[model samples]
Target: MAVVLAEILAGLGLLFFGLKTMSSHLQSATGRRVRALLRSATRSPFVGLVSGIAAGAATQSSNAVALICGNLVRGGVFTTRDAIPVVAGGNVGTAALVFVAAFDFRLVVFYLLALVGFGFHFKLDRRPAWKEWLWVALGLTLALLGLDFIKQGPRDLDVALISQALDAGLSPGMGFAIGMAAAALCQSSSTPTILVLALMQARLLGLEDAFFIVLGANLGSGLATLVSSGELEGTGRQLCYVHILVKAIGCAVLLAAWIAVALAGGDPEAALAAAGGSGGAQAAISMLFLALQLAGAVTVALARGLTERIAVRFSPPSMEDDASRPRYIHRRAAEEPATALDLSERESMRLIKLLPNLLPDLDRGGADFSTQERNAFWKGSTAIVQAVDHFLVDVIRAGATRESLDIALRQQARLETVRALVDTLHDFSGVVGEFETVPPLAFNLSESLRVIVLSLAEATDGGTGDDFDLLIGLTADRSEMLDRIRRALAASEAGGEADSRRLMHATSLFERAVWLVRRVAVALRPPPIEDRAQDGDPARQEAPEGVA
Candidate 1:
């Protein structure tokens, strides 16, 4: 009994490890393909549906597809509208994986292991790209071997004893609960479903028992997504909500139908009894699982707009989600260089407007966001800037005119300068915030920096050259003033080294910040009149002021 238990335990362990390894490596290997698949969803709902199905089958995990879709949505690659069908399709894909797993790989496992071993010995995994493939192959081999062990290792065990132990058998409700718990723990319905397949093959679980567990596992996979998606914000979690809704509805409908059939005295697991072991029962259950998933997917796909509305209501978009996306610049506009650059500039102004928000305490006039809110804003803004960069790159690649190229170059420089300006201000704000009582020098300097940020924003919005001229004057020749402030800080502190050091660092930040502010002003300064005349846009002589 002890030896048999040990074998079973070992097999289960190997099976779990193998499934995880295979899924993870498969996901990694298919990253680019998966992204391309996601993009294709925008082409058509049907194409997106197909892509989602392909992605799920390739990765062997629908949870992965959900996460990827959410991220892509935030990136503007997949809108919530387009993502629903794709997400629905992933259910079918995962079911496909279960069906594939149900097949007998007992003989192939040895050959697969041998091939993978030779490849590793030959150092195929040493290559950057080939490494993931080899691991994927190895994972598949381990999974097949583990499944074989799970089936064969218990083959000699007494069926009568197993029957005795399960004499009362599992009530459908109990089986459902166990399946739900297993899927939630593993975060994959396929894991629990495959285990059920193994148990049925080993005669440890009846077909009816496996049915309830598989059903529950399917439902639990959606719950597992919700359980794990705490970090996702905005429309980013919309996918998770969609997942749950689809799964919940599918489970209810399927379970109700199954119960109706049973109550009417029809055998749902009739195929399990007629077919051979291993493939037969496994395939039957897998097909049923597929049907359940397909039913939900098709239903959701049909009423996608309503489904999306329900999901969004459940998990509304957050400020961070709003900021993570670009407002003006988009890939389609990149084809027209002048329009794209104009859009990029407008988008940039939005970011500049937020610069003052970075130092909310110093800039009391602006909205006062909590630290967490500020962090979210910062991340969202950063992602937006990244999107801007990608858009600019696309414009350049699409063949811009000399004038547009020149504008692109300037805009690119401006982005880098603003990034530096924001970074310096961010550091300054952190130091000023850390002071127990905001010091006079720190307050004045921060206020000066904040005013300059606001002024820069104003300047870029068609404010007088007076703003730039004054900004240049404010940033210039602060060396003597710095020395006076340092001495005042050191002497006023009454011998505390930490205070002096912090004040000194704060002053340094102030100096760098003003310098960056000047650079930004210069970058945003309108092009010289002569250069504008040389270009065809005689109507566009005034230089556009850049924001924050």
Candidate 2:
């Protein structure tokens, strides 16, 4: 008994270790393929399902697969409908552990180690072909190692122990609950089932009892699916629910079959053992399970299609779902500083795209909106700017390589400059629209400010001259433009075409905006990253007025 228990525990450890090894190495090796697959999944439901299966199998963890699926769905790589089938496939694909664990276990550990070593060394090689081959070698090695480990450990367990444990006078309800608890504790249905099978092989329990436990195991597996479901919402959530439903139905069917066999005066254990032990029996059971999994996958696919149809019927036709936005970079990617840097850059670009949208309202004297709207806009802008700040700080503190840090510093300066300019614009808009007292000079400054902002925006977008050169040019042009607008407005007021006081006030507000815009641009440019690095103390004084 002690020997059997020890082997069982060892097998569990190896199973997890092998999976961990495979998932990490596979992700490093096949990250591109998985991302490509995710992108492709958006095009079709069948493709998504197949891709999910392949990805899940490679990762050896359904939870991770689901997370990626959810993110991809969020990222617009897959619609909620398309993502459903893929998530279903993920559930089934993750069951590979069950099949693998039914075999030898130790050989997998050695193979996985070899693959890891090869991957690490080969990654450093300059040859592209060598690198590609190395990744493939690593993936295959880990899979083979996992296969071997599963084969070795279970075969050595006492079969009677499995039989007896299964037969222990526990009610079907209690049995199901036990299975759920066991799976939850193990955090994997595959591991618990493998443990049960090992006990069966050790002669610890009869085959009839093993079958009931297997049914219980299926019920327990649904719990895992449910937990995974929480990661998704709307259609994705519904499809996950379907996964649980299918498994529950399968468990019921199997349990009923066992009862019928037992009542028919037949030895349920002998019958079950006959089915499981014989090649034909094993094949039949495999086919049954496979069919159940396939049916579940197919059902979700259909449900997803129906869901889309219903949604389109009820709601106006739209080309895209707004919820499709990438969330949660895998924390593990932080281990690779370069990858982390790229992720940070992607996030910055997302913010950049959102920033320009804030300009229209702020440009107009629409700042006197309803209190809620005004506050919302203010809070939103501040939140965005603060987010960028936090992201930059994190990049610096994360021990990012020098190249990564350089990239981050550039983003920081650009975003900060944008924020300052936006603040000035907002303030000017509010002031001009609120006051009736017009200052001619202020009106001139407002027009100049607008032109300067527009020019700066263009130059920034074009990535043209250095920030300094562009700002200086814009400032000179803006001064001239401000003078002309102010003179024209003052003349209009003098000619009695407009209210002199209101015009004067508008002009005054505009001038203030123009001055702030110039300061903000200068603040943004600072010194070039390369030059700053060369300085003994990298932090330098802010760029002076018109220094460019």
Candidate 3:
């Protein structure tokens, strides 16, 4: 009994670790691609199911696939109807584990262990060639090890004692209820079903009795998924709902078939074994069941597509108009550096207006965010920086007349400086935990950044125009303000309290912001192009900024 118990624990441990490792690896690899696929595939219910199955198969985790689908739905990538099919497909894909484990694969465990150990120990090396393949091998081995333990371990259980207990405790309804609870507890229908099968193989439970339990197991798995999936909304929640409906319907059909067979005076165990014998054919039967599950999923996906089309026909209008959409520098738009510069200016101006409120919004404890919301904010920020950098790269690459090159170089340098500033701001936002530092420093520093950025916008549009004098004035004013902030920060530091470290950090960040603003002013200040041209001096034209 102790040995059997030990095998069970070891098997469970291996199973959990294998699934976790496999899920993490697959998620990291395919997560973004799957997200992209769902955006378009969610058009029809069938497409959703196929995408769900494909992604779930790739990642080996239905929950991850479902959660991602849900976030996409909330992000407006797909409608709830579109998500349903994919989610249903995910349910079918999740059962692929049963197919894999059904095979005899005990020998792979040695390779698996070595690979995992090597990968863990050598992770810091930049050139770990084919490390991923090793991880995959290790995961598959762990899965096989667990399956082998399950198949071989149960024969030694005290069957007669367990049978007596079950006979006293289990009605058809009770068996079904227990099976559902077990599946829910396990969180993987594959595990629960295997456990139930193990129980039967040990002769502790009859086959006929196990049939209702399997029915309960499917329902329980659906319910468990639904309950967990509820934490998400839109496509994710819908996917779980569709999965539940399909399983509930499938179970009803199987349950009725079981009852009919019993009424025909057949033993359920004898019947099941005869239908699919105890040999490799049993494996075939499991595979067939999996295929049927996939077929059901495909059908569900088709239904969801139709449902989505109908919903779209009656969709409501959004509150925000197209004109209200904020424009930012786009990678495609960067081909035209002048256009990119224009977009960047607009983006800078938008950020300036947002500065006062950004900290407050981020700081608000009650600000509710969907996963999509946070992802959009982060992705948008990344995209903005990337687009701007692309523009700068293009400008640098295009070698021009010496005079033109000097202007371009200065502009490029200015952009690089501002990019550094924005990156620092982004870092600060992350450290301060999304707008938690809503104080005067954040406010004033943001305002100063806006002023410099606006000055750049003017400079980019044929050299600061009327704001050239304004830029100079603002630069002098900001210099004075920074000096005051620095003195205040130093005084705060002199107090030498325990919180001085944090305050000093804040001061450092503020100083960085000030420096970025000053750089922006310097970059935007027009060189004496008119004077150099009038003097007909090419040397003066080629001078870098600040040359005597």
Best by TM-score: 1
- Give lDDT tens digits, candidate 2, residues 1-548: 46645555665665566566657655665655666567666567778778767766666555556556644543434455666667667766766655654555565657666766866775643565456445555555655554444334555555665545556766657656766777666655555555555554445544444455556665576567557555354433444444455456566666676689889998665665465555433333343344445655666666676645553443332212222233423334445667766775565445433333333333344353543343345444554555455546655777888887787787677667656645655565555445354344544455556556665555445343365466765564355665676677766745354555555555555555556556545644545644445454433524444554
The Cα local distance difference test for each model comes to: 0.78, 0.55, 0.59
Runs in model 2 deviating more than 4 A are: 1-3, 103-166, 225-246, 249-277, 280-288, 306-548
List TM-scores for all candidates, in order. Answer: 0.84, 0.53, 0.64
Model 1 worst lDDT run, 10 consecutive residues: 270-279
TM-score quality measure for candidate 3: 0.64
Q: Summarize candidate 3's per-residue lDDT along 50-139 as a digit string, tens digits.
A: 777776665555655666665554444445675777777877877777666655566666666776777768872244454555566566
Error of 3 at 130 (Å): 1.7
* Candidate 1 similarity to native, TM-score: 0.84
lDDT of the structure predicted as candidate 2: 0.55
Candidate structures ordered by lDDT, highest first: 1, 3, 2
The candidate scoring highest on lDDT is 1
User: Which prediction has more favorable TM-score, 2 or 3?
Assistant: 3
Name the Cα RMSD for model 2: 15.3
